[model samples]
Target: MAGRKRNSAEDIVRKLRRADELTAAGKTQEEIAGELEVSAATLYNWRRQYDGMDTDAAKELKELREQNGKLKRLLADAELEKDALREGSEGKILSPADKRRAVDMLVTTMRVSKRLACRAVGLARSTYARTPIAQTPADPDAALRTILRDYARTHPLHGFRRAWAHLRHDQAIAVNKKKVHRLWKEEGLQVRIYHPRKRGGVSSCPQTEADAPNVVWAMDFQFDSTVDGKAVKIASMIDEHTRLSLMNIVERSIPAQRLVEEIGKTFALWGGPPLVLRMDNGPEFISSALQQFCANRVGISYIAPGTPWNNGHIESFNNRLRKECLNRNHWTSLLEARVVIEDFKDDHNHRHRHSSLGYLTPAEYAAPCTHTHQPVDGREID
Candidate 1:
C-alpha cells in the first residue's frame, strides 16, 4: 500500500555519520550502502562530503544537549528536595505518589524523557524505570493476562507449570510452557522464589564453625552508578561470626588488586586476616592477585557458582543496602555515594537488629560485655 518510508533529514545526517564510521572500519561501500538503505554512490558522496569534517561533532553536540537537559533536571530535583525537607521539618510528610503523579503529568504534557521527569520531581530513576501494569487496548495479551491472573487468584499454590496445564485442559487451548511461564512472570503471578540447593554433595556442605569473631568473613561486591552513569563499585566484607560489617569500599571500578588492597586494610584493622574468607567465584575473587594475596594468610573458600546463599550473610546485607540506601537515594557524585553508603553501613551495624543474633544489633552482639549486650533489666530496646 505504501512505499518504504523515505529517509528523513535527521536520518540522512545520521546515516552519513554511520557511513563514515563503516568506511573507517574497512567495510565495503556496497555493505554500507545496503545497511543504510542508500546507493553505494550516495555513500561515496557522503564520505567525500563528511570525511574531512568532524562528523562526530554533530553527535557530540546532541549528546551534550542531552547531558545539559539532565543537569537541568538534577537542579530542579535538588530544589524540590530542598522544599520537601523544609516541609518535613514542619512535620509534613512528603507524599511520593503525588510527586510521581506530577512527574507523569510533565512527561505526558511536555513529552519529556522519563529520566528527566523523575529527576525534575526528585523521584528515584529506578521508580520511573519500573514497568507499569495497565489495562489497555494496545496490549495484545491483555485478555490472556487477565485470565491467567484470575486463575492464579483461584489457585494460589499452582506455579506456571500447573497454570499451563490448567489452561490447556480447561480452555481447550494449545500453548507451550515457555510462553505461559514468561507471561506468568511478567504479570507478577509467580509469588514465591524457590532456590535450589544441592542435597547431599560434599561440595554442598555448609560450614559449621563460625563460632567466634575473626573466624570467617564473607565478601561480596555491590554495583551501582552515579546519576551521570559513572560506575560505583562497592566491595563489602562482613564478619560471618559477629555479623560485623568490616569494610565498605566504594570506587569507580574494583579490580582484583583493589579487592586485595581492601582486604589487606581490613586485615590490619581487625588484627589479622580471618581463618576463612567466604566468597562467590567472581572474576576479582578468583583472580591471581587475590589468590596470591590470600596465600598463607587467609583461606579462600569459593561457593558453588549461582548459590549466593552460601555467602548468606553478605547477600542478606546486599538486600538491605540496595533497598534502603542504594535504590531510594540518588548519588550525584562518587563522593556522595561513598559517604552515604558508609553512613548506611554504620546504621546497619549500630541500629539494625539481626534475627541471627537474637534480634540484637551487630554492634551489641559483637560487644564484649554480656550485661550491656543483653537486654537491660529484662527489657529490650525495641
Candidate 2:
C-alpha cells in the first residue's frame, strides 16, 4: 500500500472550509471526509486546528515559522564562529603558519569540519590541506645578520638606509636595500624616534623654492651648553637645493658683525653668493650690520616672526645636527665643542647619505654645481 500524503496549511484550511459548507448542506461527516479525500479522523483534526484560520493567515503563519527556524540556524553558526576564533589566537593572524595553527585549533578543539575551519580562519582550503615543507638547515642570511648587528652597534643613530649603504659601498656587498630593510626589521634594529608636541599655525610669508644648487641658502641658530653650563651657540648655513652644510660655527656668542663675517667666508668658499638668503626674523639677522652686508650683494628673505617652517631647510639640518652630534657628545670647553662640531659638519657633508639626493652625500651632490661657478672675493662688501 502507498504511504499517506501530507497537506499544506493553506490546503488544510481550504478543506476545512469546504467541510463546513458540506455540513451546512446536511452532508454526513463520512461523506465530507470522502469528498475531501481524507479519513474521518484526519478531517476532524484539521477542522479543530484550522477552524477559524483563513488561507492568508495560514500562509503567513507557515512563513513566520520558516523564518524563525532560519534565524535559529544563523545564531548557532555565529556562536560557533565566535568560539572558534576565541580558541585560535588574540590579535591579527599575519603569517600563513599562524593561520594554519588557527585552522587546526578550530578543527580539534571546536570540533568543526575542515572546510568550516578554513573558512572561519580565512585560510584557503587547499593551503590548509597541503603538508608544509621542511625548512632548510643552512641559514642564508647568517653573514648578513652579523654585519648588520655590528653596523647597528657602532652607529646607533643611523637607520636601515645607512646600513644598506654601508653594506653596498663600504663592505662591497651586493645586496638589495629592501632585503636589508627586511633583515633590519627582523633583527629589531630601528632608530628610536622622539615625537614632539605638534604646533598649529600656517606660515604668513610666502615660501621660497630652491630650484638649483646655489639658488637659495638657509641659515639658523642652535644652542647647547658646556659642562660648566656656559652657553655654546651654533650658527649653521646650508644650500637649500643640495642640502650641503656650508658653515657650522660654534661660538660663545655670535654678534651681527661676526655673523656677517662668517657669511662672507662661506660665500668666498662656495664661489659666490646665492640668489636669496633665507632666515628667520632674529635680531642678528635683522640688525643694521647684517642688513648693510646683504643690501646690494645678496637678497634677504626673512621668514615671518615665530614661523620656523618658512625656513625649513635650515631647521631640518639643525635637527640632524642635534641628533647625530650635539646629543651624542659631551663638550668640556669651547675649543672642544668647536672642533667636535666642525668634524661632525664635515662628516655630514662627505659621509651622510641623504635620502632626498638618492643616497648621495651633500658634497657629492654639490660637486657638479661647484664646478660651474666662478670664485668671488670675500672682502667685496658694501
Candidate 3:
C-alpha cells in the first residue's frame, strides 16, 4: 500500500512555482496534476504554500515569473521576423506589395491586430497601404529583366544598344528601345571595358626630391657584349637629386669588391658618402661588403625587385647610355670601351637636358655642390 504523501517546505515552494507556470500556460487542473505528479486537490491546497517559505525565496520566485513572461514575448517576435523577411530577387528590394502581404499573413496566422502586426514587422502603416488600387498593372519590364540577364551572359562585351537591336527586329519582341534602356540601367548591366596593364614593378618606399648633390645616389648595372663575344658589365651611379653620373665603371666581370672600391673612390672625391643609396637587389649592391660600406656612412634603400622604376634616376640614365652609347657602337677592346663610355658620360652631364631638372643639364644642376675648382666638360667635377 502507498504511504500518505508528506509535503515538505521545499516541495511546497516548488509545487507553488509550477502551479503559477501551469496557470499562465492555460493548463487545466487535471493536466497540472499529471505534470506535477500530484492530485488536483494538492495543487489547490498549495496555493498558499509561499507564505511558509523565506522572504528571499519568495522574491526569487516572483522574479522568475516576470522573466518567463518576457521570454514568451521574445519567442513570439522571432517567429514573426522569420515569416516577414524574404531574400531580394534580381537585385530588387522587397516591394511594398510584398511587405503588405507579409503584414496580412502575420495578422491572420498570429491572431494579432493589423496595427500591432505592422509595428512588429518594422513597416510603416502608410507604406503598407500604398498603391491602394487593386487593379494596378504589373511591371512591363518584368520579362525584360530576365531576358537582359540571359543576353548579357551570352554576349558580355555588347552594350545595351546592341541588345536592344537584337530584341526589336531579330527576335520580333516588339519592345520599345526606351524601355530596354531604362531596364538596363535599373538592372546595372553593362559591357566590361578592358584596362591596359601597367609596366614595371611599383615603388614601395616613400620618396622625396634629392635636395642636394650627393645627398642620394642611385646605383645599377648594365650588360653588353664585345664584337669578339666577351661580355661587358658596367656599373653606374647617378646623383638622385641632380641626375649627375657620379661614377661609371666598365669591367668584364663587375664583382662586389670592385663596385665597393668604385663607391669608396666617390666618397673620397665627393667628401663623404651620400645620405641614402638607392639600388636594386642585385648581388653586388646587396652583398655584405656593400652593406658594411654603407653601414655608418649611408643608408641603403633597396627597391622592390622587377620594379626598375623604383630606382628611376639610374634606370633613365642606363636607358640613355644603352641607346646613345652601347647600341650606337661596336666595342673591339675594353680600353676603347672605357674611353668611349667616359666621353659619352661627360657629354651627358654637360649637354643632355634632363626634363625633370627643368631641361637643365645634370652638370649645371650639380654645379652648386662642386665649388672647389673648374669643371672639365662636367666629367671632373667631383
Measured by TM-score, the strongest candidate is 2
Q: Per-residue lDDT for 1-382 in model 2, tens only?
A: 9887878988999889888899999999999999999999998777766789999888887789889999998898888877787777589987666788888878887798887788788999999876654223366888898899998997788899999988876688999999999889767798788867667767765555676778789999999999999999999999988988898788999999999999999999999998789998889999999989988789888887887867777898899889888998889999999999999889888888888887778888887764333224422112
Q: 1-382 in candidate 1: lDDT tens per residue?
A: 9786665335557887787788899998899899988788876765554444454554565567679999998887766545444433433324555556666766776666666666556678886555454434677678778889998886564578667766665576787879899788777787764555545434354453466787778889989999998889999989887788999899998888977887898889979887778888899988999988877777778887767767778897897688668977888999999999999899778866565676566788888723212223543211
> Candidate 1 at residue 380, lDDT?
20
In model 1, the runs with Cα more than 4 Å from the true position are 1-208, 369-382
**TM-score for each model:** 0.45, 0.62, 0.44
- Lowest lDDT sum, 10 consecutive residues, model 3, at 373-382
Summing lDDT over every window of 10 consecutive residues in candidate 2, give the lowest-scoring window: 373-382
Q: Residue 30 in candidate 3 has what lDDT?
A: 94
Point out the higher-scoring one by TM-score: 1 or 2: 2
Where does candidate 2 clash, by residue pair? none
Off by over 4 Å in 2: 1-137, 197-202, 369-382
lDDT of 3 at 21: 88
lDDT of 3 by residue, 261-369 (tens): 9899988987787767888898888799988877777778888778877777788789778866798789999888999999889877886655576546777777765
- For model 3, the stretches where C-alpha displacement exceeds 4 angstroms are 1-202, 205-208, 369-382
Worst 10-residue stretch by lDDT in candidate 1?
A: 373-382
> Pick by lDDT: which candidate is best?
2
Q: What's the lDDT for all of these models?
A: 0.74, 0.84, 0.74
